[model samples]
Target: MKNTSQSETISIIGAGLVGSLLAVLLAKRGYQVEVYERRPDMRKNTISAGRSINLALANRGIYPLQQAGLMEKVTPILTAMKGRMVHDLEGKQNFQSYGQKVEEVIYSVSRGQLNKICMDAAEETGLVNIHFNQKCESVNFIDKTMTLTDELSNESRQVTFEHIIGTDGSTSAVRDAIHQVNSSQHDIIPLGHSYKELRIPPGKNGEFLIDKNALHIWPRGGYMLIALPNEDASFTVTLFMPNQGEISFENFDTPEKVKDFFKRYFSNVVPLIPDLSQDFFNNPTGKLATIKCSPWHYQDKALILGDAAHAVVPFHGQGMNCGFEDALNLVETIDKYPNDWQTIFSEVEKNRKINGDAIADMAIENYITMRDSVRDEKFLLRNALAFELENRFPDYFCPRYSMVMFHRLPYAEAKSRGSIQEEILMQLTDSARALDDINYSIAEKLIKQKLSRVQLNPN
Candidate 1:
């Protein structure tokens, strides 16, 4: 199987954010693409809402979209989230800036809308064909064929492919197929926390009820509620809590319990959502998990990307961004080895697996930071010191979150560097209560001794 011919149709399973964007990227390079999606086309259908946690689109995601020329289409749908707006129990609010630079911000976008945009862009290229409602039932690597079943008709058909890429999400059929023949394994690490989505409708004048530029958080140590502003002036609120515990989702079994929980903890949010109980019961509680798989590819015939390969918890807001990076990296790999797909697949897996694992760990850590650490005075002091350190030593020091969100550095490198930076912050802030209380002499010595100057974007 000489898999690199541009004339050969590349079959991509799961016409999701990654797959759809990949189709556009491949089609641009003159390859014909066929995208198989199990769900109906969202543009033409009314898909159920409330399950999707609003995506936080950052620089890593934006760069790929810009490269694909889809940023123009995507920009209008984004709501810039400057930083976390911590909402205390007594209704007091504090804003924490994500970065000192004005440009360092993340945008909140609907997952479905962004997917639709990518799908539309892919179709616009005229070289990509998206077959909606066609579920990929199975893949046969030895035979180079797959079984696609029509969701509406319950009819199955076999389609041969030169190469297949899976972007079908965490519970991927394509990954399962590859697992049968490959020695590599995959793991799904659950965070033991579940989330449910609720909405805060626009005000009477169709204005935002909260600060439109920030992501709101009500961190309660054990459980937390977050809200992101949407394009329609509404806020998409999500509650993350344990699955089974004293203050878990199981405890809020009734409407009264749910409403009472909100009034007690998320008191400020209670007034915004009048039908809180109705929304709580109506929306489903979604699980939070990280999918870690080694060797996201199978020879020259098949590969997997995005959530299908590395699904991280949404705490870091890089799930979509990471998937988009995978798409970009794959396309770039194809560009380098245009005719040898086995090499390309091998290179992608080797390069991406570590980064994927790093982000997974960071996202899980961020869950705790968002739910508990943000409320601590020590945490705030260190966060501020991190920015000041970056200001003082531009090349040598960058905050871990900033590196992940604002730059294209490998997640593995970011995690490694962030670990060293954390040690520096701990030492610098161990005695200091504020920025003025800190000693620059000790900080400079520590940063110089432990860290090396880094290129912001190696891409």
Candidate 2:
């Protein structure tokens, strides 16, 4: 093997957020990084425009950006959101703070903007080259060669590299190639839920139509509509519903039906969204799913990260955050074994497989909680009690949502602790009328006994 210190030429498939950030990270470590994107560069041309998924940037995701020294520039684009602003069927609104303190809030950021920032950061390193309009058509992982197609000209080119990283997202072409080689261990599980995007335009004078600092949700029994504020004073609205069934996306045959459905269920939103009909008809509906793949790396030649390895439903708003964590985790693993690709790949797969699956499952569970449980009185009580416990026992208790969102806790740990915390909440709140009804003595005793202290290491 060549000296571990020798510069390794790394081919990165997909120039999206994860791929771009990985490029910056590796390039800073003196690796020659080649990044390829299938689409026209959004930094130059318009891409995804209105249909882009606006991201919820939390602590886990922010830590990675800070590590890359990109937060100094990226933080300016973020809009702080401290909690959920739930609007009822009657249009009555309520605020639910995400955390007890002032700094415990997520930021709303445009996905395209964040991607462009990472891409720019990578290119500025001079060691990274981002080839726009170049798509990875297929890969010969055995020989470590890849065929890249020019999307604009439909021309193909082949490149050889000892190492390849696939962050091309859930529908990854490189991953497909890996699947062709070994199909037994790779699977994409579909979530029955699908989502459609709508926009709530800014009011006159660029004023926000609703509260500007919170994530707004309209939770019905079976499905829900959520709106996250954007920097341009507009809000990105998403409707999550089943693909089939009476109350699903399949049932809304016409724009009129959609409007009527909205008027009946989300009546207040009718006036708030003036272009609701046009948007309902014009915008595309997207499917939600999770990808489960074992051995994320193939013999040290190729590896997959982010949505490619484990795509989760976006209910918990951790899909991007988890992907960011993947980048950080891999970077740390690489630091541990700077020159050993085989060891790096194996350790990454070992370290992340369970955490990835755990977050995916938790994201799915959160979908139900967001759409149905958010409005439930029992759910509210449990949430309140959970927050109370966190307030009382800062070291021993952290609400599952807070742990996942506010702290850098591992997803598997959060999910495990969350399950226990959830059971305790169910037991205490199952019959209690409200917070006053729950016995603090028994609750604190159970928490201290069942849950260990959450030690947050300083970053």
Cα RMSD, each candidate: 1.9, 2.1
TM-score for each candidate, following the candidate numbering: 0.98, 0.96
Model 2: ten consecutive residues of lowest lDDT? 1-10
Stretches of model 1 off by over 4 angstroms after superposition: 1-4, 49-53
Point out where model 2 deviates above 4 Å.
Answer: 1-6, 49-51, 457-459
Highest TM-score model number: 1
Per-residue C-alpha lDDT of model 2 across residues 1-459, encoded as one tens digit per residue: 112343578889988889999988887777788888888889889778323568899999999898888999898899999999988999999898888899999999999899889999999988899898998999997777899999999999888988889999988887887677764487778888899899999999999999989999998978999999999999999999989998888999888889889989999888888898788878898888888987688777888899888888898888888888888888788888977889998898888889899998998888888778888888888889988888888888888999889888778999999999999999999889889999989988998899888865444
TM-score of 2: 0.96
Estimate every model's Cα lDDT from 0 to 1: 0.90, 0.87
lDDT of 2 at 269: 88
**Candidate 2 vs. truth: CA RMSD?**
2.1
Index of the highest-lDDT prediction: 1
Angstrom error at residue 326, model 2: 0.8
